[model samples]
Target: MTVTTDRVHVYADEFDEVSRILARTTERVRLELIDGKLRSKAVPDGDHGRIIQWLLRICMQSRPELFLHPDQGLKVQAYRHGRARPDASLASNDAFVGQGEWADPGPVLMAVEVTSYDSDTDARDRVEKPRAYAETGIPVYLLIDRDTCEVTVYSEPDGVRYESARTVPFGKTVVLPGPVDIALETEQLKDWVH
Candidate 1:
């Protein structure tokens, strides 16, 4: 069950054990298996937390039938040895009505990521994740880039990357089309911190 990458090793079916071991530590870390590598990061900062909350609340109010899940690990069929834990997710209520820990991307409407301070974090949020999510057939990938002080909604997945994308600044409104069409108010996304 070992998935070997260039610089890291991950066990495909050992996520539960790994999570259990990591849970004993004081640091709040999230883990994902991608491209046969184990990727880990500390839970986002307070501002990121607040924004996720805002998005969740708004999504709930806009579409009551769709459930907003925050920081839940998604088990995707596209990647054999990967789990994607998006910042926030919009999915049908039936997707997890009687589910357990992990979620399948089949019923997922969109995935959201709030970029972090580090360059690697930013790259993953901006580049790697979007491509992977699209390849998995997730309809939308919403990226809130802290460094750029902007939001990008990537849609029209073609099994490689998004065919369409829209970017807007902090003070503008970003419209999410199709499945969960809603205009997001981004005036309060907050400025980038040095």
Candidate 2:
């Protein structure tokens, strides 16, 4: 679940400092800056980790050059002021080399987020992330919605938002479009959701 305080505005630099301190102090939580708001992301559960692993295997098999980097922090949104930690960032090997805690979203081919069973999942994963990733011009954004048991692929980013979004059930096949051209046989996704 995300803990957001709309009343208190946060700057990117302040958020960065806090995020770094959080990283150094603990591994129990992750902090994100979205729309100038400070939000905390929950640690993934066992099933969430398994789903990422499953996709990692598929990505390696299909496109050996790209690696699915888990929990990669990215600078997203307009002016690149917003910070986001995607579940998995699909990028070429060594894309994040020499970069600090948060890397530029330019090299990211796709940003992936798996929904956690939380009240804010709809607003955070479905609404906010899509806009942030798109504004950063990330080619695609993949949302694995465990709540709905569906995979939504948002692609063809037009700088403001993705022009297309295709959703498929857990047992169906979904194609992650170009830049991330891989066909996923999501039948196995059924095993990962509650």
Candidate 3:
């Protein structure tokens, strides 16, 4: 069900069929419906997976009150695009129950993305996804760019983009804002060779 074009025309009702078809694929791919178009990209390399696991672990260990989910699809009504899956997501433990794989972005506090393997793929994570998350009113978007070897913390969403951002290299620490008030150490994270 993956369309080859850069933009795929589809109505909101076809999401379930699209989701089912994508689940059986072997590649590390992400699909989002944007402006009545389907955007898809193969994600970062194996190192990025490790970074996601690390971030998830740290968030879970440091903030016991907040609930953390990896690869959780978000259903945001604010955009023509209806759904998105951040690499890692953090929200209130009791935000909602039984959301059935796609939860409203209203309950989300933070979304994380690690850069993908290609430049085009990296651009999607670095630019497009953050814009979508911010517009959805998610307070935090942490982008771990492997190509640049830096982690950026984007906050203060103003309905268009994050109004504030702080970036640090792999060995430095980035402080996460509210609901996840803690400094994360990036010493264990590695950079991409390319």
Strongest candidate by TM-score: 2
Query: Mind giving the per-residue lDDT tens digits that candidate 1 earns over 1-194?
Result: 34233465566677656765666664577777655567776568888888888888889899988887887778753555567788888997667666655677788899999887864786578777887788888999999887888889999999888999999888898999889798898887874333
Off by over 4 Å in 1: 1-11, 24-27, 77-79, 191-194
State which candidate has the highest lDDT.
2
Task: Tell me the tens digit of each residue's lDDT in model 2 across 111-161.
Answer: 999999877789889998999999899998999999999999999999888
Q: Each candidate's lDDT (Cα)?
A: 0.78, 0.90, 0.76
Better of 2 and 3 by TM-score: 2
- How would you order the candidates by lDDT, starting with the best? 2, 1, 3
Give the lDDT of residue 128 in candidate 2. 88
TM-scores, one per candidate: 0.87, 0.95, 0.85
Sort order, TM-score high to low: 2, 1, 3
TM-score of candidate 1 on Cα atoms, chains taken together: 0.87
Evaluated at residue 59, the lDDT of candidate 3 is 73
Cα RMSD, each candidate = 2.9, 2.6, 2.6
